[model samples]
Target: MAVPETNKVMRLLEGRHWELREGPFKRLGEGADQRLREIADNTSLTNYLRFRALIALSLYDNEETGVHLERHARSGIRPLPAEGFHP
Candidate 1:
């Protein structure tokens, strides 16, 4: 059977809440880029880091696509809630 993902991995996959406030694929820019660079130089860690980056990017990209679709589907609706507004 496949092993269940740990909370730490899930958290990384989900990313920080602050990133979500900005946009869907929030860390696709400088931060991930820099970390990947640092990891690339180390052969032992490069594979693990690259895998983590791929997982994070995939989750962020998938979420972003979903968000865009939701927005398009609701284009005629009233304005969305401001960032901090919950329900």
Candidate 2:
């Protein structure tokens, strides 16, 4: 079973109240770029969350995010929430 924290995160990633997901990380600045990259690149994570990390990375000036975005864009991920999808 998924850990409680991870499970909650997965729930919030789905189409729901945006704040639960955004509020915590919205204030995060460039400092989070590296960690966000780690999350984006963590193959063990659900693709939905991985893509979410990429979305957050867009707020910063990290060039590496572009590469992740390109890879995800080509990954056939639809612009949908991270509920029952994986791409």
Candidate 3:
């Protein structure tokens, strides 16, 4: 599936207001390790913790900022403009 176009993903990676919960950073079956290594070799994510966190955020169920998003929407607050939509 196409990744959601939410800046919150990057924001979660950057350690901003939203925290990533129930991510997908566990064992990835057989050849998954090699795939991960290849990806790490090509990408900029240096630290394993950060990389795993990123994978968890992406490869798994993802974030839980519904309450936060609702608050922002209600109060007329917006994420960084780069995120596109306010929610």
Candidate 4:
């Protein structure tokens, strides 16, 4: 079973309140970037949650996050990594 905190993080990631305000590759501002980074670095979160965080970061044009997602995909994980997703 997933931990409560991890569930909460996942919920937050999917929640409308935190939805990306712009198109992919658009900057989400510093606050949003920091929040995504926080979620990405949180070891307590499930890999799925971490993946979502990385996706969110990618939408903000974070290249490093895209690379991390690619690595996860190469490892053959679920939710399969996105391809050709620059930004």
Candidate 5:
């Protein structure tokens, strides 16, 4: 997705203004982890999206997600574009 569109989604997610009709994990089941892994692994995506996916995985509180989050934290990678919002 384009940066603007991705940013819009991020805002909705972060703002808690959007509700999942079906919980993502429930809807995707085991595939949720796979999808998160794919998003986390894809370097082409904005850091905001990748980080958000990582955070979502962490929220699931699974061992794998914890490991991934730990690795990501240790990497010290900063989000691209620096700032997420503009007035």
Candidate 6:
């Protein structure tokens, strides 16, 4: 998802305004972790899209995913979700 083509696609498809979560493609399972990481790390993508990738990663309950969200918050990408919101 960090690739230029994917970045361009994101640019073309990002929402005009914030909307509630409609969710990303699911059923990808753990194999998608690395791609999601790339998506979350791609600064070219809007925070909204990157944030969706991060939220997908958050489902794994992995420490690194947590770190990504924290870093994003500190970097002003977006605020970290409140605790227990998804539990």
Best by lDDT: 2
TM-scores of the models, in the order given? 0.24, 0.48, 0.25, 0.42, 0.56, 0.47
Greater-TM-score candidate between 1 and 3: 3
How well does candidate 6 match the true structure in TM-score terms? 0.47
- What clash count does candidate 6 reach? 0
| Candidates' C-alpha lDDT | 0.37, 0.57, 0.36, 0.53, 0.53, 0.53
Residues 30-55, candidate 6, lDDT per residue (tens digit)? Answer: 44555667777876755567666665
Angstrom error at residue 32, model 1: 2.9
Off by over 4 Å in 3: 16-19, 23-42, 46-49, 52-87
Q: Clashing pairs in model 4?
A: none
lDDT winner, 4 or 5: 5
Candidate 1 contains a number of clashing pairs equal to 0
> RMSD per prediction, one decimal?
15.0, 7.1, 14.2, 9.2, 7.2, 7.7
Best by TM-score: 5
lDDT of 5 by residue, 1-87 (tens): 112233333343343343333354444445465466567668886666665666566545678777776777787666433545211
lDDT tens digits, residue span 1-87, model 1: 332233323344343342323342343433442333233233453244433433344343345434544543476743323212231
Tens-digit lDDT string for candidate 3 (1-87):
233323333333444343445342233333333333333233354344334333443443323323323434475533333333222
Off by over 4 Å in 1: 1-29, 54-87
